[model samples]
Target: MRNSTALALAALLAGAGLTGGCGGASAPGHQGTPPKTGSSDINPQPRDSLRKGGTLRLSIQQWITQYNIGQVDGLQGDGASILTLTEPKLWFADDNGVPAANPEVLVSAEVGTSGGAQVVTYKLNPKATWSDATPITWQDFATQWKTRNGSDDRFQLSGTTGYDDIANVERGADERTVKVTFKQPYADWQTLFDPLLPGSAVDTPEKFNTGWIEKIPVWGGPWKIGSADKTSQTITMVPNESYWGTRPLLDSIVFRALDSTAITEAYLNNEIDQAPGRQPEAYRRLAGAANTVMRTGGRWDETQLTLGHAGPLADVRVRQAVTNAVDRAAIAAAQSAGLPFKVNTLGSHFFMPSQDGYRDNSGDEGRFDLERAKRLLDEAGWKASADGKTRTRDGAALKLVYVVNGNGSTDLPQLVQNMLGQAGITVELRKVPGNDYFTKYVNVGAFDLASFRQVDNVFPSLLYPVYRTGGDQNYGGVATPEIDKLIDQAGAETDRAKAAELLNRADALLWQAGHSVPLFQTPQISAVRPGLANFGAFGLRSERQYVDVGWTR
Candidate 1:
């Protein structure tokens, strides 16, 4: 099947990416070669009717270090652990990535702006219960907000720029109802309610602020944590029989940790049923087997080498020279294994392209040009120093330290380094564990370059923390009044095209300023075995949880 798809794609490439003679006499088009789009071959098993009883074994690259839903800092590739087994949100978005009007836990939720209250109200389903069997009520909702706000701790939802929009939340006259008020006209109200924690666990909002409360293990989601071993890298989750909605089809789910090579080997040997974030080559090998391969929309992280406007990098011409020097297309092509859609240093459309504000500025950023880069360096007062390998300005060599979360995608920094080397810049790569890397180092501005990933599913407002000035979470210290203004407008502009226009303007500015290097809009891909049911619910690349899955024996 892989061979056939490659052949078909090869046939299709003849007519595309070619505009006749301008690409030089020895152009790739003249070679009559077709481009690769990752692995073109995948034969997914036909959908099978739902059946139960088989244990679904999965070999994930990462382990579930913490079980707490709200406190777990990183998505950690263990999102299934958070969303499926341990906790439930007010509502889950549909396949289209839009918030659903009706959710399993809540009958309906509404935010009323008419009243001075500026409240977001939710009506809970009476049947819902914590894994411990306590009734989930509006009080729980109120407690969730208070605890998140008061905690001032790691997982404080209120402190997060996204959730800070809420003014306060209160219980309605009836215990089943909850009302929340926002301090400002901002989006992300959905995010506040979605990571709902149990209200019964605490007596006061202050007590809940401690991040450790998550270990107590109260849940309203479909499954409950039955057993887990942090050292052994295994976790077992059992269905919550008393769940308000449809019960999970599997009796239990076991997560086993394996490195990249080990995971692909295990899946090919049929030791595991599924795996996400495998290498592109691994997917290519698996495409021939009687299994299904799919892409998920999100990634673990990204790395950007930013110029400090207040420091030596204050010159706009220097920034442009840096931007023009590196070749994004070459980096993309190499990183993608010759796939046609390799993307390099993308602008501020940081969120996945599916979101309303995503604008593609690949052409505007300009492709790799060694000659142009040399010219820019000369113009910026950076002359080739005694060492041909390095560039110097004001007697200071352009030496940068690039850092990355030890557990993140390895392809990012490597590609950036290669591109920079071609443009005469020296970069030193540093790796740190995921925990200390983001909190102590990246957040506090310890590194010159880093790659991190942020998944914002609800709306465009997710950009506030990453893009705005003085944003607590802004790792690169990138602040642009133009970007902030456009993000603000894009968030409020309900009209699609207008919002895109505003977003594109912001994207161009980001590229022009050299704050971020636009990467590709990654596709959401997933690989599944035959007879796996309801697996597509895992959402693009299995980012979303699979509420329903069973086998067709």
Candidate 2:
């Protein structure tokens, strides 16, 4: 559970078009060649080229609200990115989002069936310890499990699907081992327990939610929080001397809060070593910088328009009309304009085009057919005004509130507004502060339609929160029993082929219902210092081995 909260947070920021190029793959036409890893390649470098001591400087869109990412208010992209260096996951997801075991923390994780129930036994590495030298034990696991299982609402967790499904968590012989028996089978079992918090951090609701808001006392990975400055909006981390795994290459890592618009300037000024280059304008500006390389590739992140089921968008026909009225291709082209690679319009809400089991469920809904859109709106009781500038239904104009983060360029939303205006829909664009974008607008359902990109996990089963009825992240209020059934069926499946089939079927329902419009899969574009190695966007791996990130001197 590598900060599951951060996963959604990253998606939220990506959706807002802030850091669209953060995860997975280089941009379409990378100009430079990456160093090849031959048989003589070092563990984390090419031969003896890695330099071990330097401060890695990075930038983020906003300051983290809380240190604990599991809490609703604390779940954020900045915090999650920082935690990646401080936390230990049972497994790390590859660039393609596939989960793989991490032997640094886990000796082995065995999954089996006992009495028709699913069972997982995790054996911890004997040397695993916190920064304070406390042994990582089963008690820590039980503490986190009890706080986040959803049985108790005081902890304010982001999601509890997996934890709630567990029948029991018991110690296996000694503190070094534990067994988790699931009341129901969870096919994505490998996705759990990145690192369990010490008992002090999760022993109670108050401790779980507010204890780490200012400082995270517990540390279990290669790096521990060194210093956090609220005034300067920076957090510095240093290597955890007690780490049992191979020592990290960098002496320290510093994450600073900077406006998304200033990232390119910062990189140019040498204030930061690397920054995402998803924005076409920024990529163009940094394309010829000295000692820098721009890498790009397709990312799992996607931008889309989410309809609020309670407003004028309540009618499925109205949602369909809105989806059809917008020209998705134009929006994608505008975002990718001047870039070296061609951008494709994304069609599936569940899987990217490059991923397996992807299907173009967009069908006619994704096509820009103003005539069809008008027909659908007219059928939904909205009639165009005499001047043909707007639609009126029962004496009220078909007006919509479009909410987005205020930090990035408004070109995309403005383009969407113009396209929908042709269909007689009036859009009022609301630019909220970037820090408050998720809590004030997205989570509160304060907008009639919201636009943001979402980052997805490798396992489709992990997507239940966005589509499942009454799920924590289901801000669209999409409640369909049939879709829920398919999600459940897919999660219960042990066969990968069958799970993909069921998930696609559920995704089809999402498309037809006009729950959301799938947009383009943003490419991961970033400019890094020439000698910087083992960092930045990758195609097959999502998680970064910070221990391996260094400079080739």
Candidate 3:
């Protein structure tokens, strides 16, 4: 249930990130904790055993104005709940983080070599067709690779990770077959082509960047666009009648975008059948709701503080001081309060403690040491004021802006503010609308500090785009040479074990770099109707698809 690499790291980091923690309460006497090895809690129920039909209502923390997940502005909320229903993933992962090809889109996925270069061969499901009735083909695969390959700068992407490692993507024996040659033997090749885009959506830079803005121009999964009302900030997905796989039982699924507090209210008011129990209010309200069941699972996710590169944090020592000042234990305790689950503070950038490759690479940077924080500031030329309440250097107060999206726990930022204040640093809490959180804030380097969660994947390389310099998700603005080398070598890594070591070494540097500080594994807590099947806190199952999600009588 828990898992690494630049050779393998890219795959590991690739399928992850961007968010507010999803947390909640378990039933009385229920311990929502993961086994030491980690696990998922989706309340599995076979398709045939489920009820024939029912609408599933869900409250989502984020609504995508830019619907193309590969694009620069493409981050969705935790679990990407909307993407699961409306998009296509060629593969799916079980609780142990092992990948399996999705028969709905891929017949078989095999790894081998071509001219000594690692290659992956994919056979498309013959029955797989786009919403427009066009057959899903190798061209779609090729185009997706090309657009995200990082060759053209016009196409602002969230990641060039696995795509950039490819040597080429060509057709195989048939139009339905795809052959992708990698420049090196990257680990977890299955992480590629996730929510695979149609060529029409990615064939050109202009289309790839803006085509899906405020709209889903294409559909490739069990569902198609029913309506996306911007005014209401809700998306309605209906079953795709042309889908080749087993027909989805639900007539429609509606994802309503709401803040954490509103989501809790909606759940308690019975306006939404399923809601994220991340908000404390939700946990309290749903704790006694007869029809609601609390679901918690272990995940390859962590809530972190990303220090913006510009401003006072530009100095590495200042960043390190900030990291040293944070009491992750206290924050974790607060976030997990009133819940049976045990949420521990995270220590590595690449792996969760419950995962196999995990190591406490954080070292001294991860420790709470106010004295060391003061020393680091002093060494960085920041001096405490005569009053000793705040630091100042070069006519600038040692102040940092902490941006909050208003969708996550308010306690986190406040805690941060109070903790930093003790270290003679002034932290200003700036609240932003959830909609503009990333595009207008995190992505633009608009704040000195920010809080968010990353939902990780089996393929740790998915994190490449997150930690590298100018990485799409690198809001922290801290990328070290060693980290870069590991990222470069990740695609070249053939040995998973060695690759994991390489990732840990890089994470050590990540701690040393101090651009980002790991908080706790963002708790995945959900409140779902008892009848809901195959839907809940999906731990490390990043490769999951929504076809099997339905009601169990």
Candidate 4:
């Protein structure tokens, strides 16, 4: 199981309310030698009439969970991908998923304390404007802060442990200058700076504060929402001519829903350009085909096992037993041919080990051992049931419902269920639609166990929502005062050394407590057509989207 903070974030982001409208911008001529876009470097190409009007089909197993930017809780990475196709954040990660010091939309971003609240300052790009020709300004940031930071559902700042210190936000006398003041010192302030919301979108501060989450969002990105097929399963986007950044290469992009088997077939038949959620080896098989190219996926993107935080699961012995009972090496092999890395620790309060704070605890606490698992359960006062397939205490059977994305491979949970069975644990595998599945089942803490996956970013973005107690994303029904303290400090921590120390300590604590069972870190490798030059970051957050990419000869 992953940590509680990430689960909370997923639940909230699943319902984000964002609206987009884009037009064409002036194109820059091509410049650099033709190179893969998803590679480490941002190869700049000069402006020209891009290979326009070719339909790029994308098959992402599930539909986008939510449209709201601030309210979105769980699917932050997926939301980021969608925004890249339709909007621009003040500070976005470069092609490498590292936060760009200055993006095209915002000139600079810095965090500080103001009146006992964490304050974030944003300087807007003079050329940046919404699709409707509204210039992005400080008023927009202030209004977004007022609306999202003020709401109960909004997970952007104050409500989340990452931003618990943010007190308020205000605009400077100049429209381009804005400030966000926090309630306490937060370490993860950068999480809110990206994909900024527009002021024009929030005309009624009351509406936003009152849960009118359906409001159409105003966006400033390369593409705009062209045709939303609420009836069918397709969503079409066209290049926004008024975009402040480089003119988009493609005329239109389509996001279509397809079954897993059909997605692979579509890629082979040239019906789609790409598909997300395919296993690493499966993606490897299709890469470098006649019309396709494949690349390696990144860290901290894959399936996870979440132990319930409360009720029967709150027991440390139960959590430890579950962790040791499953063989992650086998699970990783089943998912990929040893391509995915085994993670034995409860995910660092944040998802990625590459981030500033990460500690491996799998060696000591998360080792796979059915005998030890049985011993732990026995010590916890559980004995075999009459059927010998389950453990019972005081006549109550140790039963768990394991939830996972039904559209993906069934082998993921089946392997886990089989492993747990060896320890006499009865796990009921429940497969559901990936779209908003986290929100429906995990968010409400409705299930006993859940197969989880989250796209991790630079640092602390997914922390508060996943770990903090009562966190909207805390679907695991679990929390610890120590974990909470470490995560909260990590959010406000500005110094790299201190933040890393706190996060490492927190990761160790989680493993000791058996809060989550570490699975493998999934890769972002995928197949792409040869002509597609810029693939962007190859993970969950930055997938095979065409936002910061184009064709080059």
Candidate 5:
């Protein structure tokens, strides 16, 4: 399973609180081209048009087991998605995932260097307080730092990228101000504190990992947990009376856990007000529904193939052959066929095709060339059997176990299996429980190959935990000194241009190493009530203002 910290930060930044600003030129010091408005199927509704006092019933793929996003058990995307509603970060991203100061939580945040060390000072809004009326303080910041800084293994932190580099977290003259000093420069420091765990949650290891299970003892955002029913597979949330920002327009939000297969039906039956339109059949079904609008856009999440290094994939040639054998374009077409909007195959591992700095570094390896794939396998000593249906090396057949959570359409994996079989590769499909898929298979290296999607970050530093050696989310167990040095160099560089160059260089090494194969970007698809404001499939802007999502008239 991915660590809670990096996953939380990525989900938060990619899909946290919303900010105001139209598309503009790339920010100074940032690399890549500026974000494009791009193709979107969502019908925009003005915030002022929304009415107040209603409950929004939403569908979630999985029931959350842990309330704290900082713990390993709570690192799942479903938990992070829920936390976005209940936990407010000091800094949030605009619709484009651009880091923006959140005045609701922080009055201002300034970054600079002092004594050759990078420093960040945050000034909190005086009115900001938790649900219990506890004022957010420097203690909260310090508690989070100490608990997640990797000093104590018992805490089970999701990541230690920026936290491990932190030398000290000091409070200023008052509780409203806190200063953070990093031993080395962390260019993406602004992305650090959105899903900040409260002092009560992080004060002890037991509290950090177990206290938040099924119960949210603290709240810092616009809403507070009202109740959760495991039997009903539902969680209810109410407006936080202590909230200092705009009062939430909706009386409450009910997140109901539903099977992915049943989500579209739930939407159709009026059991849920919104459902993701990822499946073409679902989108087509929802398209004709009354009082509903189909929204589609380029999502930050990218589907990829992760090969385990400890199993049959340990041979780099095998990984390379597999990469060349799969046809990404065909896969994208099959997934998006007959859909309302077109979807594109993702080329880069780090940036989206539309984003700045994105390049097709996959080279010839990404193409679907069975000849080259077979040649590579032959070079690696995997000879075709007499039947020519599968390859064998030293009497052991080239069999690969492909595992996935039994959710949504199986077309992707089934297609991959069929394609690989044509190239004499035997792929065994293993479906795991969606709830334990990450922890049981992906995290523990229980399968030869796995398929999953990841949301990209605005800055490259967020990639550290996924590609760096010994990273908490390094699924493939890729460890190389060259890769490590390049990643560290990129993280420490203050100059965005230089960092982008270093990141691109490092990406080349990743492709050469065949760490993972980039498949295609999942089109952000959703069916929403026509009057539903501030809620739908968004591009770089994934965060929604929970307080503002409601019906219009």
Candidate 6:
């Protein structure tokens, strides 16, 4: 669910996910360091070398209501950990985030120039079909483009990066082929039409919004939803009998929704096969556990505070003040403790430390200074309370609710609350159930400050949706005209280095405006059971043969 094509294709972060880091660790071993780049601790074995049947049990932070990742309500972080199993991943990416056609769904994708525009033609596998036997055709591609191209206000979307540049999607060489002509040059075009939604599911605004709620009605991947029970908070995935690729080696894959604490216990009790112990506290707890291998790698994610565009946060000075009030280095140190790598405070929104374009563009705005924080808040006209407590303006208290999905073992919510309080702002901590966190709150901008991880993609320009004005994914809704132009130029630039330069320039503006407070990049810390092939901390790589994941022979 993460990669790059024209722009970057990415996912949300859920659970107690260990995020962003530039360095890699040693090969996975008992109490050993996390694996480095070009190495994923998933003991991958060829299908012939794997066992016939087994269940890969894993835990997720929440149960998701929406099944479509393209929709606003559907873009849960844990939702990503499951959708690749049932949806079409037309392109598979390598460790470097370079994408290539997947033979199961695509035969070839050729790029060419058409009448001053860039056109990409996709050749679909004639054998590929949805779970209901609907062939994977040009219609599916056309529907996705229509729904996600930012031309329609009726369709609720997560983000329209590459899709926004599409001029049209037409059938080419019959129904199994699609030719997408871009309105402008989209440098990351290879990322479009991925996880292609069924045409019927998004043909209309009504169907697009509600068709996939609480149900996965159609699928075109290695596995199908066997059962999705909210009562049990578990999703059971079985092999898709109609899948036109290598048969899935495992009999089933089960995902159980458990809180952070429960997931830790489930792994230690041997009830689950994989556990994410990315934070220092949990990482130490699971380290050297009997019969477990701790796979560590570069996590291309940064935990941050997404400020709302509305309310008092709309003031740039207030946003910058709140950002400066928090101690990012302390949080990084807390999370990095006992880890084999040094976790640096994240300073860029678009690139992770592992990527080439990464730069500390934060400048002085990223530093922690209580005096500066108070000065900025005071300058913004939020006067300190008469009693020397919270700030007040026009007889109203300057208060904010910090919405969180899961209170990680790191106690990040508490730390942020205490620090913001010191700056004379009353921070209220509200814990939402994982299932409702995005749909009920964050997506709608229900909090002043929301805590989560922003998973960076290989292509920096793909972040346009997260930073551009009126972009749906820009939950904070903070953007200057200068930032927008830089992001636009970057997204259109075909040159990688030039595009990275433009992105960094735009990132500098975001820091000045306090779009988000980047805490630190996370690490891929997972305690995986022995012999679980092709499944572990995948690091910068996003593709895995879900069908090939099984117990090693």
Candidate 6 stretches with Cα past 4 Å from truth are: 1-39, 385-389, 406-410
What are the TM-scores, per candidate, against the unseen true structure?
0.78, 0.91, 0.92, 0.82, 0.91, 0.91
lDDT of 2 by residue, 1-553 (tens): 1123433102322322333232322344432222111101112355257887999998877777777766766556567667767866677665456666788888888998899899988898898887767888887777777877888988887667677778888899789998899988888877556545677667888888888786787888888889989899898989988788978889998988887798899999999998776777887677656756665545566677888887788899998898899898888878767565546677777777767777787777767799999999999999998887899988998999889788667888899899999999999999989878877888767888888766645566556877888777777786689999998888878888888889888888887788888777766667777677776655446444588788888
Per-residue lDDT tens digits for candidate 5, residues 230-310, read: 999999889888777877889988988887899989989998888876676875576667767655555466778887886
Stretches > 4 Å off in candidate 5 = 1-48, 542-544
Q: Kindly list the per-residue Cα lDDT of model 4 for residues 1-553, writing each as its tens digit.
A: 2222121001111122211001111122211111222233222354352454566666655555454545533243444456555666655455445665446777777766555555677777888888678788877765655555545443332243333355656676567777777666665566664556566654463433323232235667777778767556777878878876766667787877666767777778888875432364454345324555443334455466778866567688888889888887777656544222222223444545454345665665678888889888999988976665788899988878887767667777888889888888988888887665655776667777886665454455454666566665666757789888887677667787887787778777777777666576554444555556555233323432355466664
Off by over 4 Å in 3: 1-38, 78-80, 279-281, 542-544
lDDT of each: 0.55, 0.74, 0.75, 0.59, 0.74, 0.76
- By lDDT, who's the top model here? 6
Pairs that collide in candidate 5 are 1-443, 16-543, 32-356, 32-357, 33-356, 89-194, 95-541, 277-525
Against the true structure, candidate 3 reaches a TM-score of 0.92
Per-residue lDDT of 170 in model 2: 87
- Cα lDDT for residue 496, candidate 2: 85
Candidate 2 error regions (>4 Å) = 1-48, 542-544
Sorted by lDDT (best first), the order is 6, 3, 5, 2, 4, 1
Predicted candidate 1 versus true structure: per-residue lDDT over 3-69, tens digit per residue:
0000012222233331111111222323222211112222222334466556778765455443333
Error of 4 at 450 (Å): 0.8
On the 0 to 100 scale, the lDDT of residue 544 in model 4 is: 24
TM accuracy, model 5: 0.91
**In model 6, where is the ten-residue run with the lowest total lDDT?**
5-14
